[model samples]
Target: MIDFEIPADVAELRDRVRKFVDTEIVPYEKDSRVTAHGPTDELRRELIAKAKAAGLLSVQQRPEGMSHLEQAVIFEAAGWSTLGPVAMNCAAPDEGNMFLLSKVADADQAAEYLDPVVAGTTRSVFAMTEPDGAGSDPSQLSTTAVRDGGTFVINGRKWLITGAVGADTWIIMADVPGEGATLFLCHGDTPGIVIERVMNTMDRNYVEGHCVVRFEDLTLPESSVLGSVGQAFRYAQLRLAPARLTHCMRWLGAASRAQSIAIEHAKTRTSFGKPIGRHQGVGFLLAENEIALQQCRLMIWWACWHLDKGAKARHESSMVKAMVSEELFKVADRCVQVLGGIGISDETPVAAIFTDMRAFRLYDGPTEVHKYAISRQLLRDAAE
Candidate 1:
C-alpha cells in the first residue's frame, strides 16, 4: 500500500547527493573535533561552493517550489553525512527560518535577508526558546516587542538559540500586548542585542554554539515585522508542521547509517570462534533496528505526502517526530552496544550519534509535549 520508490528525476538527484556526501562530507567525519553543528564559516563557505558546483545547494527549493515528498528525499540524502545538510545549504534553523521568510517576507525583506541566506553568504537564527519558559508553549512567549515611534523595541532573554554565535540575522518571536505574539526580523548586531554565552551542548559541533541571548531594548523598524502583527503564533504553527517533518527525514538518514554500521560489525566481529551475528541475541537486535528504520521511513513518507497535498499535518508531524526520535535513539544506542568499547568511544560515529539522538527528544517540542497534543486531538475527534 505504500510506495517508497522515488521518481526517476528525484532518484537521480538522490544519487548525486549521496555521491557528494560520500566524497565531500564523510571524510570530515573522521575528525572527531569537526563538531556536528557543522563547519566554520570559511569551511562552510568552501563546502557550499562545492555543493553549488555539484548543483546540490538549495535543491530543497525548486524553481516552481518543492513537493513535500521531493523535499523529504533531498533532506534524507543530505542527512547521510552529518555535514551533508550544511554543505547542501539545507541545514536547520536556517532551513526553517527560510521557509517561514519565504512564506511571509515582503520583496524588500526577501532581498535583504532571505537572498543572502539562499546564496549561503549569511546565516540566521530563530530565537524562540526562553530561559524561564516558552519551550513547548508558544503562548507562554515572554519576550515583548513594544512599538515606539516608527520602530519596535524588543526586550527578552532567549536561551538554547541555535546558530546565534555566527548568525548575521535573527527571526525573533515575541509577545505583543493586546495583539498576541508577533515575528520580527532583527540584525544580530543591532544595538542592545547581547550574546550572553554559547552554552555547550551534548552536540558541540554546531556552527554557532547554542547561545543564550539577551535583548536589552533592541530596536527594529516597522518594516522588519514578518507577516501580520498578532499573527506570529499562526506563522510559527504553520512553519513547524513542515519543519518537524524535515527533522524526521534527516534523522532517519542518520539512523540508517548507524544501523548499517551495527550490521557490518555484527557480521564480521566474532566471538568464541564464530561471528557474533550468528547468535540470536545479536541477530535479533540487528533485526529490530532494521524494522524500526523501515517503520520510521514509512511514517515520514506518509507525513510528507500529506504535506504535499497542502494538508496541515500537525498531528501527523507530531506523531512522526515522537516516533522517529525514540526509534533513532534506540537504534543509535544499539549500535554503540554492538560495537562494544569502540562504539562508546569516539573511534566511531555511534557514540556521537547516540548523544545527538538524545537531544532530539528535547528539542522541537519534546516527546511528552507531542504525546499530550496527540491525545488532546484524539479526544476532541472522538467527542465530535
Candidate 2:
C-alpha cells in the first residue's frame, strides 16, 4: 500500500541536480586538481562556484523544508559525478558534521562552526576512528579529554579522519574517565591539533582524502563540550544512521552512472557480427545491475521513510548500508568487465567509479561487522 511516487517538488529538484551534474560537473572529471588524495581545495571551490551560479549548491543546507526522504532523491542525483556531491556541499564528513551540530550545537556554537560548513565556505571532520582504536566498535575509543578547572585537556591520535587537513571544524570523540564517552567541538587550528599525514586511499572522490591527525595537549573551555558528558555515543547514533543511509543514496547514483556508461559502450561496440550488448554475457550483467540498482534505491527510500517518521532506523540503516555497498560494488565491477581494457584505464570514469564503489564497501562500516551486529540484535530479541 506504499506509494512509490516521489512528490512533484522533490522530483523536480532531483532532475535539476541530475542535469547540473551531467552538464556542469561531469566535464571536470579529468581536471588536474583531482589527485590521489582527492580533489584539491581549488577544484572543489570552482565546482562549488558553478553549482552556486546554477542555484544548485548546498540544497541540504537551505531552509526549503526538504525531508530525509527528499534528501535521498537529491543526494543520489549529486552522486552522478563524484564531484557533484562535493559541489553541492553535501559530501561527508561535512554533511554528517552539519547534521550532528544542528541537532546538538547551541545557537552560538552553530553560528560559529556549523554555518560556514553549511554554506560551503569551509569543510568539517568527524574524528572518531583511530589507529588500533574505534572503528566497527566505537566503544574501543581511547582518546582522552581530562577535566582541568574550566577546561578540558585533550590528547589523542586519530587516523582515517576525512578532510582533517583542510577542515575548519572538528567533532572529536574522547573517553572521559568515570564519565564514559563525550563529544567535543573545536576549531581545526586550536593550537594542539596536528595533521600527521594524508593517507593515499583508493577512493579519490572526497574533497580531502582520508588523513591521520593528532591532538596533543589540546585545551578547550567547558563550552567546547557538545551536548552532555557521556552522551557521545547517543549523538553518534543520531549521525551514523542517517549518514550511513545517505552514503548508500550517493553511491547508488555512482553505480547507476557506471551502468549507464557500460550499457552505452555495449550498444556501440560490435563483436561477433553484432553489438556485444545483444549477446548474453554483457546483457545479463547489465540486467543484474539494473535489478541491484533498483533494489538499492528502494532500500534507501524505505530507510529514509522510517527516518522521516521519527524512527532511529539503526537496524534498517545497518542492513541497507551493508547490502547496498556490496551490490553497488558488484555493479561497478560488472561495468568494468564489460568495458574491457578501457574499464581499468582512465579513458572513462568507470575505473574511478569502480575503485570508489570498492572503497564504499569498507567506508562506513565493513559488511561483516554489520552482519555481526544484525545477528546480535536478532539473538537479543529472541532471548526475550
Best by TM-score: 2
True-vs-predicted CA distance for residue 276, candidate 2, Å = 0.2
lDDT computed for candidate 2: 0.91
Per-residue accuracy of model 1 over 87-119 as CA lDDT, tens digit each: 888888788888888889999999888988988
Q: Give per-candidate clash totals.
A: 4, 0
Cα TM-score of candidate 1: 0.97
* Model 1 residue 232 lDDT score: 87
Q: lDDT score, residue 39, model 1?
A: 52
Q: How much is 150 displaced in model 2, in angstroms?
A: 0.7
The TM-score between candidate 2 and the true structure equals: 0.99
Candidate 2 per-residue C-alpha lDDT over 1-384 given as tens digits, one digit per residue, 9 for 90 to 100: 999998898899899999999999999999989999999988988998998998887788788666888999999999998899999998888888899998999999999999998878889989999898798899999999999999899999999999887788889999988998999989888899999899988899888799999889999999999999999999999999999988998999888899999999999999999999999988999999999999999999999999999999989999999999999999999999999989999999999999988889997789998899889889999999
Candidate 2, run of 10 with poorest lDDT: 57-66
Whole-model lDDT per candidate: 0.84, 0.91
